[model samples]
Target chain A: MLIHELLPLVGDAQSVVEVSQSGDALRELLRAPAASAYRAYVPDGEKMDAGTVVVAFLGPKPEAHIDAETVAPALRELPVGGRALLLLGWPVPELPYHRLLDELVTAGLQVLQVVPLDKVSRHGAHCAVLAARVDRLAPLRTHLSDAPLDLAGEAPDLRALLRLTGEYVFGDLLSRPLRRNLAAAGDRIKEQDERIRALEKEIAARDATIAKAESRLARARNDLADLRASTTFRIGNTVVQGARRPTRGIVSVPVGLVRIWRKRGTPGERPGPQS
Target chain B: MTLLTDAEASKYWNERHQQETDLRSGGDISFDEATNYMFYLRRLTMLMDRVGLQNNPVAPLYLLDAGCGKGYFSRELAKFGHQVDGIDGSEAAIAHCRELGGGPRYHRTTLSGWRTPWLYDVVFTVDVLFHILDDAEWERSTRNLASLVRLGGKLIVGDWGEDGDHVYGNYQVVRGRDRYLPLLDACGMRFDGWEPYRFRRSPIGLYTFTRIG
Candidate 1:
């Protein structure tokens, strides 16, 4: 479809000049249509006749993107007023490549229509920039290209003025939602950040309150322990317990009081080894 | 120091504006005058060129300097023949702006609370949103500013272009792309691009968007 779709734009070809690297699928797609097709694996400045369509597909196989070194030779071989059909394949993201376009235009090729190749094309190319060699530069409508979405393998290219659009449009329609989603996700992140900050503050306050209560509880427990270990409380408890029986109070009360009196003066906290 | 409450932050900024009379009051106070003159002002001039305002675009383009600190940008824009209005939360800042005004009308108003009848062709908030410590306030401010821009108008803000929000010191928080993009997209504003200031160690820059009908 790449050759068939562009065959009309090629016009009445006196001869077809096919230029590409050796063993590339692009060379196989180069059809002459009623003229003898000349193959140049590595073009070494072989000049051709006028009305010859220089058919070439430059893919990013051994190199990165389309470079001038590979493209210039094809232009060098192309005679004046001849047409050049180039299928450009990019390894980078989908976007308006002005640098590459400007390079082609500067090379004395008056770009006619840029046909963007689909996924199933013989060569997996970004787009086909169709142009003819002209003497003077021509006026342009728009730099951007678009066409109706075609399921069929028919070649597509050139449409719409990008800068003149009502809304500023970009290259990929698919990435639009992605960009929005990423942005919305950021909003959510900020919201979550606020929530996290609030939660952390609440947690810190709760921790302080918990610590204060624990300290007070510890102080109260210590006070109760000290009260129970007092000598007066022990003597009082003994007297009360002995008082429950008649004669027991008389002996136990005096004994408890005497023990308390001795224990009060004792230096050791608990009875020593001898005691 | 810890992050300040909204009231405390407002007080801090107002007091700051009152204390300093020069560019140091609103811009980076640490930077010397030479550095500011050579780097800071030059960077802004370049950005204005990128914004399509440097060469004097269509005359008298209505513009709003959202959160215009001390009214420098607003005054500068007004000098370009555009009707400019500046609003800031700091009372002292607005007072300073009015006293030194070349042309712009100054108003003392917070970004979130800012409400007006007029819609501007360009509403720009530079190095301001990061100062709003509260997240909800930041969102509201961004949304409100976007709302202020008429269709086919521009809304430019200064913030980090990278992903994820970053907190610096007490009052500064750099909200990333996720925080800004989705919200603005929902507002029908197509993002133009984000260009970094690229001065000193600063990662901050201008994020530009154009509202669509």
Candidate 2:
């Protein structure tokens, strides 16, 4: 059976047993250890002998059939320090599992450990499994006598364990590529920031150039105003204010003065239309 | 001449016509307004008489009031002993036509969709062609109007001649004199003549054509 091949992966077992109505799946446990035993039991009919590790493979039942009466009696029949591995395919609601665990403890059994097994298959039908051990039933009398039963453990029920495992697998499948893409996106954002800074610097340079051109234009206008104020510069008949004095040879004359001088014909002869 | 049946067209024009009337009247009903209405009716009667329509009544003259806003011209033509019909896409305009006392049977529809019940002696569309958005719709509408006119029947088109884009009330159009003549000629209608009417006051020109058979 495949279970024999798979049990080695779970580490060593001193005394393994398979208790199922049908001996097919139980036959797989024959390869666990040489001391392992297998048994088949009818519902509510058998009690385990001393020091036997009772591995019970109960088949599917209706949700209403799973009560303390149906489970506690069989679990109480186990001897002290004798381990019992019970397999079930039902989902346990909150507070109800605690009550059921309390009833099992009250029935002269000490629970050493409880393990939930996921990914269960029975001749191709998917199911969940629960495994527990019976510690010394005598020490249970003083263990949390006044307080409530402490069934808190890391392992969840079989259904929840399977769901959690599947979710882990799916989460890894979805987020691994997303994490890579996010790193690439962060790099692109940094590159864009650099480009934006470069563009800002370029804009600042262009703005400075525009300011320089404006200042130059203002200075040119001031120079033009100064040039227009000269006495040699004449607009229509008016003379400008600051210019060279009118001397004999190198005098700078206003345009109107030049025209008048030319009209007067060099201060002597008649002005013949100022040829 | 063009027959049109549009379901929503009439109701839309009717509402618009009501609103326009409300705005135009401004809640005033003076004797002067009544006199103006009567004067318009008398002028329309005289025009119809001059057209020889009053003397020899024409059954279903197949008149198309191009831009027949509220069917003002159509209603008058119908009252003057002509079996006339008008079509306009404006809901308010169509509603006004329906409200008018003893006017033509008016339809609220577009020129592109008008289908004449029979060939018409006169297919008249006034001040409507330039509202066409493009040359394609204009050509199609013009051809459709021209096709309604029987051989030797008159096709009258009134629009702005030789104008840049201009606005009148809510209407905007671009038109010129030579713009439509070639198109009309190609649609089996011969240009009879055109008369310039109200150049300064209205800037409108009325062109008359006849189906060439």
For each candidate, the DockQ is 0.01, 0.00
True contacts kept of each: 0.00, 0.00
Q: Count the backbone clashes (under 3 Å) in each candidate.
A: 5, 16
lDDT digits (tens) for residues A1-275 of candidate 2? 12233333223334544444334555453244655555543445555655445454443454212444555555665554445554444432212356556755675555532323323444321221222343422211110012222223333334434433654576677678877898899899999999999999999999999999999987777666655444333332233322333352234345556655555433322223222
- lDDT at A79 for candidate 1? 51
Q: Model 1 residue A213 lDDT?
A: 100
Q: Candidate 1 clashing pairs?
A: A183-B182, A184-B182, A186-B178, A186-B179, A187-B179
What is residue B165's positional error in candidate 1, in angstroms?
1.0
What do the candidate models score in CA lDDT, each in turn?
0.69, 0.51
Off by over 4 Å in 2: A1-275, B1-16, B22-54, B57-62, B101-103, B163-170
Each model's TM-score for chain A is 0.45, 0.33
